[model samples]
Target: MASLLSLRARPAPRRHRWTAALGVTALALAGNGLLAAPAAYADATASQAVDFPTHCVPPPIAGIPPIDGTTSAEITVDKAAPKVGDTVTVTYTVTKPAAGNPVDLALPADIMTPTGKVALGGAQTGSVTVTGPKKNPPVPGKGTFPPFSMTGTFTVTAPGSITLSPGDYNIHTSYIMELDTPCTVTNPPAPVSQTIIASPQPGANERAIQLGTASGKPGERATVTGTKFTPLADVTVVGRAGAAETADKMTVKASSTGTFTAQLTVNDKATTGIVAYEGTAWNADKGAGPAAYTVIDDTPAPPNGQKLNAAVAAGTLSMTQAGDTVQLTSVDFGKGGAATGDLHGVTVKDFRGGPAGWSLTGKVTDFTGPGGAKIGAGKLSWTPSCTTKAGSPSTCAAGSAGVVGSAGATLASTPNGALTGGEFTAGAKVSLDVPAFTAPGAYAGVLTLTLT
Candidate 1:
């Protein structure tokens, strides 16, 4: 008969402190022949010595009672058919009998491709949840095991760049349950599997046309480049100038890489501002949309000159304390470059004893200092009011203001010769061309007026 090797758990016996002493006393008595042998040892001779095994023995295994529980799991995916770079969510609901001890649950998943297996991103180790006592009544057909439910979620992502062939692939979900009583049950509920039908991704549908320069004049050359058209297709690019289609069109065959480049000549009579171009591919679905280039007039018309003037009357001048000299305040051309006032306080004295003709001439010195800044003499201009009276004190007549002329030009006397002092008043205006690079400061100059 064969010997059976059975493994079981048993308790250890207690040892007393007098056990070794008692064993030594018994052996001494037997050696001294004061003790008699029992029936079980009757076969042994008197000189025979008893022996015991000295090797160490291993501990027995512990046994635990079987847990009365059952487990089931169901899995669902968010999207059945997903495109490349799309996210697919996997949701699992697992049911286990509620027990006082803790239990562990695991959900392992694998993504299948046509070639091999692919990895998912989130929660590979799964989750665990503890359930309290049941509240509601159990269903009629279901067993009396009050069920505890646990839900776990994980994600599977499809890659963007690679294209997968159209086919049905299976996503398998595995479940495992373990109890704290050193026992595990693995009735994984048929490995809840779902099928995903993967289809070949569609091609990109984007088109664009670009110009080397956005703005150009008539007769200038502009480079045009078109992208994302159909490969190896005949592309017709047309340039339209302001409300006129079919003005300029060029046809070129696209390369194997779906791109083309060409040069367009701006029409000689192209209207100024935004010209458009469009590209169409022959027998293909992709083409460039309308793109614009700015067409500007190269030669613009010149601007007309502007005339500025200011008026001064006889009341604008003031007489000096000596009474022999009459002075007129200078017309100030400040940062604004213009000023206007009436000429006041002019003393009309008998110079030649009789009514004599007088002439007024204005000469302007060069504006100096403040780092040698200067304005042209011709920029200073004046228009003088004339009177026909030959008396000592004559007032200027209405509508006697003359046309403005440059102060550097000689002021002609009244009646084209000389004035008999009807109080000649002049209106002055200055037109300056201040260069952008000039230094900033106050510039002083002299203006000498002589009346003879």
Candidate 2:
């Protein structure tokens, strides 16, 4: 116990040393804690370690101008697809304007992106100029202003949309505009857009017409038929041959099932050609269809390879006598009605040797045979009135007085009806007028005819 007490001298002030050691330990622990935690800076310094975002925005798109008149635009697609490989088209039309001064417009050049998505590809810049009206524009009829335009296409990539994907592309067209100037940022036209489908609707529902020929012989008839004819109206059969051109009075109507039939006759003595006989069918709204058939006067052969008579066959009868012109021969009348058949042979001869002045007219009836034929017939009378010919001769010798005359002829064989037998001879004739200036001479006229 005595020895332990003596050691105290060395322990004097040991507390101070211990306190210094404790202080050092505390500083080390604090330094270590600071190393484990990140440094916080209130102010940032410029350095390459930091990152900042940069962005770009396209300019506002232009709009279309206000059109003064009625106009329309339609959008269609060459191909539309969400499944890749689609094309789109938009059509802009301005109508009701005059033939020359039509409403001018613009079209979008940039359709879609290669990634299969729609975009306003305005990557590049260019302008379009059209020739039209200008500002301070003149009155409607005063005079036309110069033409002006400002429309163009741009390149773009896909835009973000729920329906669109990153790889899909579609043509995005803006409404075409009617601009006062190519660069005038003023009123732009409305935009039209369309998407091209991958597959187009089938053409199964389309209508069509097929024609065999356009022209034929006078006694010949043609048949016409077409799909989607029900909507057709005012179908007419026309024949255009040399100087003799005629149109049938009957108009064909289409059936309810979109089909139509028209029977046409080649009665006019027109030169046969590809354009000889024409069939025209109109819709209830007068919409016209393509010509049904072309006409061709193929030499007709009788049944069983028989040769048809080369002589002229008669179809109808007409009489006229004003001045200087007389019936050289009688007229032969064919069957009158809408029926398929050939006409008998008929002829007319001018009795007045030369030009003369006279007035004559007559009615039309059945035909009669020549001298030896045993066929009975009676003369046909007129309506008891005479008038100048419609659209008088455009070209006639000057200083010549016109002659007019009429003749009434009857068959001596058959009393009441048309000639039943082929014999067309021995008919009665009565003159309504004879030209006073006619050369004094014996005038004889004759008529003949057939029907198929």
Candidate 3:
């Protein structure tokens, strides 16, 4: 005769089911070895029980060990190791033996892993806190009861290591006794899952820093590499002209490295074409897929000259053999060039844009100097060549002065000595002398101001 059923009802047994039978001993698995259904069956039923209190009520009797009356929890989970989503917390303990009465702990909605589910108390129920038995007093028969604590919170979404394999899980709760009085149930047998893995520490696979061209001309330089690059920090590598965060910017930083290298010139006045090199694979996160590398130079530029500010206000560049009447200052052609100051004294201005063609003006002249020394009148306006060449050296074959046009001469003798001959009018200005041998130093030439 074998019987193990626990399913109380009235006075204090809203839910509790535990059935067990024993006597089969060898049915192996229905291959027919045990023939007629009993190899010494007196009464048997190994394991099969479920159904417990639907909601509230489960805390009384601490020690554990009660089948139907209620009180039998053996939940346990050390560290299943998580990764998929990762979140674990399970601790259980309920011994039994002190008195009896004071048990109420419930947890078992299928535990997890069939389809996987967890969200019991949010923030993971704080981490752990489900205790029972701060006080139990109701002595009567079979002793022991006064300790019940449980804590379970899991999250691992798809990815094994929890316990070892096969879904892996553990956590079963039950214990109840207050209200009408019945308490006497127990559980804790099939549970001890496993499976959680992640152990990396292998070897090599990372070496970058190679940019061939991403716009060049100004200073013209672009060549950086990477082999064993031990550079800790300071490898900026930024080349941007437009698109992706605004700010026409350019940066290049590299303090040190192994296969060693660092060159990203092109600032000699770079305004050529497609410019974008954002290869910042610096600290290493594996970033530098496709952001920079679009540099093209048709190469072929030089030979530019143009200056115009024609008379009306007053202008004169006389040196008819006697000598002395030059105080222009500067005006080189093509490729940007212009330098002349002082307005309101007559005028003296000149400039020329380069890369292809440039021009600017202002010239109100009147000088004397050959010993006569006069120079008066003012009005000079033309000094725009802060110089942003946009990448120079556009080649230069045969003649090579490549693009030549000149006009520069200085020496108005203003501090008070003599030759006030840096002449001007509308306002008053100065600067003269040059053109004798043409090479002494100041006389580059390129002035064409026709402001009628």
Best by the TM-score measure: 1
Candidate 1 residue-wise lDDT, 1-452, digit = tens:
00000001111122100000011000100000111011010111111111111111111221323443433333344555544322233333333322222222222222100110111211111111111111223222212223222221111112222111111111111123221222122322123234343232245335567778865766777777877667877777655442233355667777788788877776644422222222442111244433455565656555784434222211111111111111222222222333222222223232211122334343443322122344433443445443333553434332223322224333334321122234444323323333333333223222333333
CA lDDT, candidate 2, residue 176: 44
- Per candidate, the number of residue pairs that clash is 9, 94, 111
Against the correct fold, how does model 3 do in TM-score? 0.21
Model 2: per-residue Cα lDDT over 27-49, one tens digit each: 00000011000011122111111
Instruction: Give the poorly placed runs of model 1, Cα more than 4 Å off.
Output: 1-81, 84-89, 92-204, 241-246, 268-285, 302-452
Q: Rank by lDDT, highest first.
A: 1, 3, 2
TM-score of each model, paired residue for residue: 0.27, 0.21, 0.21
With a 3 Å backbone cut-off (N, CA, C), the pairs that clash in candidate 1 are 313-343, 314-343, 315-343, 315-344, 316-342, 316-343, 316-344, 317-343, 317-344
Clashes of 3: 111
| Root-mean-square deviation of every model | 47.4, 44.6, 39.8
lDDT per residue, candidate 3, 287-393, as tens digits?
Answer: 22123444344355555844332211111221111111222234222222223322222222111111121111222222111111222212122222211222322
lDDT of 2 at 220: 67
